[model samples]
Target: MMVKQERAARTRQALIRAAAEVFTEEGFALASLATISRRAGVSRGALHFHFDNKKVLADAVERQAADVVARMTGEAEAAGDALDALVAATHALMSRLASDIVVRAGFELCGGPTRNTGAALRWQWQVWVEGTLDRAEREGLLAEGVSSARVAPAIVAATVGFEVLGARDPEWLSEERVARFWELMLPRLVAVAR
Candidate 1:
């Protein structure tokens, strides 16, 4: 029974990986289970045994990717300072999204048929950012008038904007460019220390 469970877990992972590749290359609308199964070298029955349909497969991928982001963000939250943690988390997310094809596909899937999954992920990130801001405010790290709700979306928008731009032109999105973006934007959102 243990062996059977292990095999099932491996098969599920294989299907997710295969689907990620196809989704990255062909996108959600174009990606098919047959292509994913072929890529994974799994039979249709095996693929179906794990996921019931294409949407289900996409949801699984989104969930896995979200888990990764959550872990990174949680680590950032554990860091000493709220503002620093937010910056670190954003940087980590952008760097991962920039380099990972599967993550990119997951981002794309958020707007396609699996948009609900995307929205859920986005909401989670936004909530994290807002929570960080609230902590910063409590700690007096932020200016007195700053609202966590306002700044959270702004930061998220900026980070996601950079990700979208990077996806379009990786060559133009150097580390320097990203650093410059943060430099220019962070001050506007963060409270200035007197």
Candidate 2:
């Protein structure tokens, strides 16, 4: 029984990974269950037993990806300086997007046209960015003219843009790329460090 339960867990994870890949490549509308099953090397019956439909599978993928984002952001929140934490978090996200197919696919799925349902992952990131910026503001890290309200959207847009662009060209996900972005943007967002 234990072995059977363990196998079931593994099969479920395999389906999630396979679905993420298909959704990433084909988008939600075009991705089919057959392709995902084949990718997972599992029988149709097995796939159905685990996930009733493509949407459910995609949700699982998105949920798992959201967890990843939450963990990173939580770590960022633990830092003494919000600005440094934000920078570290962005690098972490770019690094994850570059190496983890699931994370990339999940981010894309969030605002996908065909899905047209929700963007929980992106929303989570946006909220985290806003909170961090607000913290930075309270700490008086922000430049004189900048406010968290004004800067949060721009930061979220830039990070999301990196994920979108990184999908086509990995260079966009490079540490150097994010560092350059921060180098240019951070000066404008924050005051000189004490």
Candidate 3:
């Protein structure tokens, strides 16, 4: 029974990975279960057994990707202070989006022109940033002139832009590019140590 359960788990993961790749390349409306199953090297029956349809498969992919993002940020929280966590999360997110197909697909599906699943991932990211910045403000970590309310949206927009542009050119999500962003913004955002 354990062997059968492990096999099923592997098959389910395979389907989710294949579905994420298809969704990323073809958009939600254009992606088909047949294509995903073929990409996974699984039978249609096997695919159906794992997921009821493309939407379900996409949800699975998004769920996995969301978990990754949550864990990444959660880990970031342990790095240091709120400002440090924000920095760590931004770098980690860029790296993840570059390397993880499911993460890239989740961000894509959030605002894909072909789908109406809502901007769940983007909202999730924005909320985290906003909260982190709020913490920074309360902790006296932010520059005197920096307002969390003012900077949070800009930070969210820039990161989301990176995610969108990185879909076409990987350089947009590169460590150097992300570092450059922080290099320019950090000096203004971080409070000087007294």
* lDDT tens per residue, model 1, 19-81: 988987888888889999999999999999899999999989888888888898989888868
- Give candidate 1's whole-model lDDT: 0.78
Instruction: Report the backbone clash tally of model 3.
Output: 0
Q: Lowest-lDDT window of 10 residues in candidate 1?
A: 111-120
Q: Compose the digit string of candidate 2's lDDT tens values, residues 73-132.
A: 778767759999999999999999999888988988888887765788888989999999
Q: In what order do the candidates fall by lDDT, top score first? A: 3, 2, 1
Candidate 3 structure, TM-score to reference: 0.97
State each candidate's clash count: 0, 0, 0
The alpha-carbon deviation from the true structure for residue 34 of candidate 1, after best TM-score superposition, in angstroms, is 0.6
Candidate 3 lDDT over residue span 74-142, tens digit each:
999999999899999999999999999999999888787666777889999999999999999999999
Q: In candidate 2, which residue ranges exceed 4 Å CA deviation?
A: none
The C-alpha TM-scores of every prediction are: 0.87, 0.95, 0.97
| Candidate 1, residue 62: how far the Cα is off, in Å | 0.9
**Model 2 whole-model lDDT (C-alpha atoms):** 0.91
On TM-score, the leading prediction is 3
TM-score of 1: 0.87
lDDT of 3 at 167: 97
After superposing candidate 3, which stretches have Cα over 4 Å from the reference? none
